[model samples]
Target: MNDTYSNGKDVIRITDVKLTTVQTRRRTGAISSHIVLQLSTDAGITGVGEISDLDCYRMYMPDPAAVKMGIEKVALGQNAFEIAALHERLLAYMPSYFRYANTYPPFTPASQIAAGVEMAFYDIVGKAFGTPVYNLLGGRQRDRFEITYPVFQAKKESDTERYLGYMDALVAEGVTRFRYYVGVNFEQDENFLIAFRDRFGDKVQLKALDFQGHHHWKDVLRIYDRFRQYGFELLESPSWREDYEGMAELRKRVDVDISEHISSLAQAMRMIRAGAVDVFNITIQSGGIYQAKKLFDLAEAAGLKSLISTTQEMSIGTAANAHLGAVVPQLHYAGDPVGPLLYVDDVVTEKLRYDGTQLIVPQGPGLGFEIDEDKLAALQAGLVEWDRPAHGANYVSD
Candidate 1:
């Protein structure tokens, strides 16, 4: 109102921020949090945004209080229209954000602080213009985005039966494609893939990954062939994350299209230069909407596709990724926007749903989602104050 409105674009000034930690009721080790930024405008148009979780690649979980404080320090009194400046200021305050955290220098810390801020900035801008975030990202190329559901890695014959039975419920809900990471063993994992092909092969799409990355190059080659025979589309992270040389050689050796699990943008460039990766399993949390879109463009420029990957986030993160995924034209593979359906419950009110094989992107302004106050309140009420416990797979019970 003071000087940012000389150009008639400053409608909102930052007022307050809120953080809520929600724990899963039905799952053992799956708990995620949310950060809400409330922007109070001179015109009384309150712009709202929710921070998506970015804990999978972080060395430590983001303290929501710290993120809220960071946001206020960077965003106070700034014009909401200055999205780029806001992000650049954020970068200057803390440089080198990660979709996944890095072990090197010249990089900022890896958490959802920047991502949450980015989403809120876009949300304010979108509502001011009466448009969606995808439109802000150079317009939409497609209406719906394809997704891959996470099936628990089955290691036994009975485990395969249980996986099938679990998928049966999802199939009824119109899910046609699903995937899971490799458990601990290959032979046991092979039996699981064979079951999917034998049972639901013709009815649904299939994808598999070995994120454990324990297999040798020869082992990866042999396993890729075995699963390819069963009609698995892509094999992801079959080896270690830094095995670029091995991945490059394997890409040339096998018929399976291998994807690299990228934590840093440099990792992505390395994969592209090496001609190793077939697709990118990227999370919006890796670098937020801006860098992720650029990464997708880089992949398409190199004749590959970028899949908006995920690892158990709430509806807010899923919605954020969906907005990015909606605009990208190269999202031609099974995506990991599978959070709302992954656990027993999500904290947002209007959670995303999968109709058949695709995820329907929310069409509202900004992230296109509203905070489920009732759900949030309930989660807050039910939250157990636990000390730092050993964390494990979100679905796997310890």
Candidate 2:
């Protein structure tokens, strides 16, 4: 055993919790913002966690300010290891909306807050025990895993060449797995698909064509039918999240796999019952690593595959995803924890290791990440003008 645990100083107590807001520019011309959580313990360990800003396109309202206020109310002075108890209290404090299909809200703000809290506690415990966060979850299932590189949808038809060139550069760099974003305009999507097929052929694995629940079932079917020959692996969230029956019908009409975002057990049950989803795109942003592991088990029992979804988090959040990936066996598909590579820069002192297209599971204690204080300070300064209110007007008026 390690000296930290053997000396009976193992009872790490949470003394303080701090939140630092930071934003980094993504390659897609969008800013990836996060509220970084720092849990200072009596044992002289500071556990790090990340809460991604999700106020995009006005689709969902995420309350990071509430997370800031509630973290102290729920987590201060608690034993760092009592994560389960803390989680229950946090859920009770920030209750989910239960009005829709007996399912948790598709994007529960509390879950985002809770995810950050859970991450910090796990980091504390892992450090106290002198082990990687993955060991706490179960044990390492794989040393490394592939991350599906996403090519965000072009802004307009004229930008198609630039997008294709981006793919070409990645392909040349030995990236074999990919996911393409669509749903801007069907014409651009179709033309891009045609160009992609003509250029790359079947040389690269098109892991998914993500619609992000942006299209109707019929429209999705038309795209699927036309691009069936292109051989993308799955159709991701073809319709709006609550339309289980429509998703089921679309699943029946297509031969490819269907994936949907799942937050709670009730939502997964609803999808499974309706045969709406073949793969669960489980994001830790919903409920953190422990809850994600449970979802993976549920998916496995239902004989469904799963992939870890991403909100394009920075190094800290990406490291959390890597630890989760290390333990979950049902995460057979190439996940989207590509944020470490997608951002122009990261705040970590040591970035997570990558081998060609694969991300190496971080081996250091406590989520295997250390924040660069200087970079974080600089990032926080720049985030002054990048508030959530500015993002509220990002959508079309139509």
Backbone Cα, N, C clashes tallied per candidate: 2, 0
- Residue 385 of model 2 has an lDDT of 39
Model 2 accuracy (lDDT, Cα)? 0.76
Q: Report lDDT (CA) for all predictions.
A: 0.66, 0.76
Please provide TM-scores, in order, for all candidate models, with all chains considered together: 0.85, 0.91
lDDT of 2 by residue, 1-398 (tens): 45564257546778898888787776545565678889988778889988764535244444456666789888788888888788787768766622122222244556767788888998888888889999988899988988898876655676678777767877887777888877777687778778888888878888888887767888899989887777888898788747889999999999889988777878888888998988998878777787777788999999998998877677778888888888887666788888877777778897777777899999898888878999888888323333333221214311
lDDT of 1 at 349: 69
Candidate 2, residue 122: Cα displacement in angstroms equals: 0.8
Which ranges of candidate 2 are over 4 A from the true structure?
A: 5-10, 53-66, 97-106, 381-398
Give me candidate 1's TM-score against the actual structure: 0.85
Please provide, for model 1 over 272-311, each residue's C-alpha lDDT reduced to its tens digit, 9 standing for 90 to 100. 7877778877766665677667778778788886688764
Measured over all alpha carbons after superposition, the RMSD of each candidate to the real structure, in angstroms, is 4.1, 3.1
- Displacement of the residue 119 alpha carbon in candidate 2, Å: 1.0
